[model samples]
Target: MVKQNFILFMLIGELSKKSGVSRDTIRYYEKMGLLRVSANRRDNNYKEYADNAPDVLKMIAIGKNLGFKLIETKEFLEFWEQNDTDNERLTEMVLKKIEEIDTKIKALTVFKQNLENALIKCEP
Candidate 1:
């Protein structure tokens, strides 16, 4: 079992170092609902971070890299923790992301064609 200190709370700086992600990225993930990061305010109102942040950030980064949005990532993690054996949902999510990628590829092809045309027109 992991120690309590590893999950209770940690300073943002430490979390970043431990998670191999930047503070800004962590903040973005929090905004996107990928992780829950609460602040521990000092007497002067400076903010700290909750522990377990590093692990959460790690999960978020991995999920995002695998094309999971924040919400999808959260659900995936939740289901993953519950020991669910069905992967139909996971497969669907991946397929959906692949569809999105296909759409992006089409859009990029159009843009590239436009750029090529513009370059040809401008050539002396």
Candidate 2:
């Protein structure tokens, strides 16, 4: 039974719809320890997820967009779960990611300049 205003338990289909993540991806996240569902199965034997599952999925998407690997995202989730006052660690990770992106952007810019030079050299 879902609690009122505290926790809303939803099946996989509802989670998939609300989170904008596919059922198969959600299942894979569960297998990778990136997500958790209630151990108590519904009468129909479907897994039930808490309301926060959607929020967690969104966090995963954001991490992926920032170039985090699945393992890194999982570690971030673990830090988030362990303490609310862990912003320092989270900030450090974000800063590191920013440095990596800066390096990639610099390399890509140089590569693009070389390609443009090659194109210019190709007469006609």
Candidate 3:
């Protein structure tokens, strides 16, 4: 098959190995429309994914590492795949996530301080 420069069309197992995402998660991604197998491939029981499928899985992994929910990752992927998508929208999601993380950190800091104060009182 004539391949794109560095892109690879691969079955789920090879894709999973290359992408470090498991088969079950890849199936879940297909179910969620995060990944897709062609209709012919689906019908023929020959599931070959498009070349960029691995990249999508990597992006999902990055989003998860950044604490984005699955839905958020889906939205991010949709936005990213759009031809006219701009950085502003992506920045908005990331900034909002950072704000969320900051809020959680503040709450956790307060909780830790409260526990520390309680421990101090108990020690005396």
Put down candidate 3 lDDT per residue, 1-124, tens digits, no spaces.
Answer: 2143454467888888988889999999999888877544444576888788888998899989989999889989988778536778788888899999999999999999999999999994
Residue 32's lDDT within candidate 2 is 98
> Whose TM-score is greatest here?
2
Give stretches of model 1 more than 4 Å off. 1-14, 22-33, 36-53
**TM-score, every prediction:** 0.61, 0.83, 0.81
Instruction: Flag regions of model 3 displaced more than 4 Å.
Output: 1-8, 83-88
* lDDT value, residue 56 of candidate 1: 66
- What tens-digit string does per-residue lDDT give for candidate 1 at 35-118? 664544556664466655666677777887877777888877766656664788877876888899899899999999999999
Please list the residue runs of candidate 2 whose C-alpha ends up more than 4 Å from where it truly belongs after superposition.
Answer: 4-6, 82-87
Better of 1 and 3 by lDDT: 3
Task: Choose the strongest candidate by lDDT.
Answer: 2
Error of 2 at 118 (Å): 0.4
Question: Would you list the clashing residue pairs of candidate 3?
Answer: none
lDDT of 2 at 5: 51
Better of 1 and 3 by TM-score: 3
- TM-score for candidate 3, please give it: 0.81
